[model samples]
Target: MAVAPPTTSQNPLQLELQALKAQHPQYHVVIWATYGGSASLLPGARWIRRDTLSISTNRRNSWNFTYGTHLYDYYVIIEGKFEYHNKRMKAADYSSFVASTAGFDFGTKQSVMRPKPEFRADSWMKHLSDDLLRHGPLVLDKQLDDVLDDVKDFLEDNDREVVMVMLSFSSASAVYEAGKPWSEGYRIKYDEVPDHFNREFKKDMKKDKDLYTGKKWPRLGEVRGKVVICRGWDVDAEQDQWGLHCRLPKWEAAHGFTSNIKPSALAAHRWNELVGDFGKQDAPKSIVLAACLHHDPADEESWIPPLQTAPILQRKAEEHIRKSTKKTKHLWIYGDEMKKKTNMAIAKLNFLGSDDVDFTRPPPMTVKSAPVLLVATH
Candidate 1:
């Protein structure tokens, strides 16, 4: 008696097994196992008992076995006692065991699959850092906007009655290169300075279209009136020479330091001028200075301390308004200390308030001890 060949009308399991084999021609045998055990059968059997079995025929197809408990009981024999005894072995382990018993070889041991690129934390960090480095200016501008927003929130939190907003730069020539004067005497006149600054500011703003369009100034609720001043002065006397006549004299006098002054003194002078511009009626209770100071790369001996400048400037501002009835409740300095390079060195100060100083006494003056020249010895 001869047996008939398997046809489409065969049992569903056999047909499915045949299709699986046909789908993965590389896989010689696909061992499908089902655990036939109950939770009540053993004390800790549930811990090892998996709801479904995991099997990968190839890289593309992963098979999950979820047939009824008795489907392969006769052949596989993984019933109550058998399942409890072999609970430690997983579905893949069982497949390997059966394959080894029948003298078949699967590949090396399986490894835990890695997460997708988007799901990885380090990938997100790398992407953000790369984007920031690529678009440095735009990212810095957005950060400035965020800083301004925080300043606005801070002012609101304090419930300041009168607010003053001032933006001052130590060296305007550093930022607006085209606006710098040709020579010392031929410097751009004070009258032409505003036009030059406006032109340069507009040009720079136009360069990046995605810059923050919102109001850079903070808006206070209770204040009847506010003073907002944005001014930039040239500090590089050797390069532009305009700063010598334009604002350097005033800066030197107000700075109270020697002619050869540090960037911190220049910054302090600028802050004093910003605060002194307003009269008694509009004197501010809270002051905000967004100061931009230039760091000379040639002078390696001197380092720009972005942290200390705010307090020094605040002291100068307090002294300037000492006689007035209005006292400074808050003074925030958001400083950007930039060096002469392709990329700017940004230093940010967030919500730094002023320190109380005894202004009735005279301001401390630094006495620069002159070098004593010894006469030619006898």
Candidate 2:
């Protein structure tokens, strides 16, 4: 799991998102924070390519439109880079409120200061209390409703490229908590237990054992409007560890990162993961493929490095596996040029090749490998 630090505006946008959830309780709003400045707070970032970009809400979420329930009022896309901070602190050990000592105060006839002299009682406990108390947990100057309104406008305005997806909390915890009905006070009430489980024991369990044949992955690759499958688990290239090569067996993952797994396992595994829409009735199996060039252990960038473009893509396109291509059960991304571009951290799925549509032809797994490339920003 690529656990990034909480972005700078996380708290503020979170508070605003909570308020928006309270207001709109009809659709499933999925907010996709791209690289930076989440759409819920910052405006004019992500956008959809269309004639006139405008907010469209479907009161009757249905299949006619093909868009999920109109479920999400829209897509909140934050298309910018991010600066992640690294902090390893446990809440259990830290004090919530620290009271600064007298050393911080400005008083007449104060004692002279020394390099490492500690005479005053006010040091760790009472240092910087004024700023800490004044600023609060996070900067909370903006109104929740106002922030949401800005998001709504940016999404509907249709001029910007960045857009936000607005939906009902009926889908996720954030929305549900934000939209909880409140009469007297803002603290709304909610029933966390899923609604589908009521009035039945284990009856609600799936009847088909093979309902989801493939694994649930952390990363997803969309190819020609379908889901693309990639690597498997079991990084160790050992005989005993080779069993994870099966697609369905190693599908349960947080990120689409299975490159390090043994080749033997990959041999047995057909698909790396499932995506684009799994359970939908009319969902298609369209998949795309890409390769992260630096996946090789010898590649210095594989561990500690910055972004740079070289012959990596060409190298990838030239040597894509073919035996894997013959069994095109799903989209196979093997071209050497399909190098790792994005490192969203769901395992090794960093390649975001150019969005080239190949509905008529299959990927390099069969014979000719298609080259798609994405630039690594950070």
Candidate 3:
């Protein structure tokens, strides 16, 4: 008798799902963020209404839910990008949080004025491994499996382009230590988990890519309605690393935008880059952005507000449209509450249904409804 391959308690599907959920619980935030922005104004693009974005109550608990309920023809998940801190934090406190989360005992170490290898803490990877072992894999494989299967179906389909921007939680710390050697050492320590998760997630995604081998599809090639795929993360070919690179944009520098909130700027940069890259190349008819929700949990003094993040996304989308041809963008939200909150936030931006411009598409009417009907009543 042939023996089946041995399987572990946590399969690849479960592992990937755990990593994604832990990093980006609100995974479809990108779609919600970009929907009302300028990208929706592109001609020939379909208009998405607020009511249509609600997710079934049953699916709300699912981490691997399909974005927009499979309404689009093509779906693509962009890799490399992960959620970063949208607010400021003290370096020492930030370091402590990461170390504790990873199970490192930073308290035992004495404060040193200068950094040396002797002062370096243990490899954070060990703590992370232990943490995973302690928590065990979350029971989310089934939902995630369904989501990935949906993407696989899109990849096989030759009709249109569908993309999903996936954001990774690259680290427990939102800000990395810079300049000071002590902080630099801590940054390196904190990055261990993010680096490992990125490698593993990409490995799983590549398996999906392999399924497309031997199939040939025609490129859309500047037909004005070609489908596009937009990824939010930066992929470094030389280093084989996938994540955001620490850099300052000229505009932000001129405006004195601080480092903690660079993720917003990066998000905008990736949006414009997609427009330029896709406009120049032939691809699918639809674009999917795979990005993290980037909403942080409640904290001591204050919480990361979705309202603040909403404008950043709006600005990013607006900037992209100003530089490239406009296209219809889609929005999807998981629940009624989120949909309402997101709509309100987007509305306040004055980018949608504003005095200067209107983003709401005219309601579709059938032939009979369009005809001038004369009242026959006496």
Give a tens-digit lDDT track for model 2, residues 44-119: 2211112221333344432222222211112121112222221332222122111111222111011111112232
Q: How much does each candidate deviate from the true structure in C-alpha RMSD? A: 34.3, 20.6, 16.7
| Error in Å for residue 110 of model 1 | 62
Q: Give the TM-score of candidate 2.
A: 0.24
Over 4 Å off, model 3: 1-299, 302-307, 319-378
lDDT of 1 by residue, 20-50 (tens): 4354222112111121111111111101112
Q: Model 1, residue 197: displacement in angstroms? A: 14
Task: Give me the overall lDDT of model 3.
Answer: 0.27
lDDT of each: 0.26, 0.23, 0.27
TM-score of 3: 0.29
Model 3 C-alpha lDDT per residue in residues 1-378, reported as the tens digit of each score: 000111233743324434433443322122221111111211112211122333333544522222222222211121111112323334343332232223222211111112222223233322222112111111111243443343344335423333322332222222324443322323223344455754675566556532221112312222112222222233324443432221111111111222244545544543553444324323222222212122111222222222333345544544544554443322211111123334333332222212123335334323232212110000
Q: Candidate 2 or 3, higher lDDT?
A: 3
**lDDT for residue 340 in candidate 1, whole number 0-100:** 14
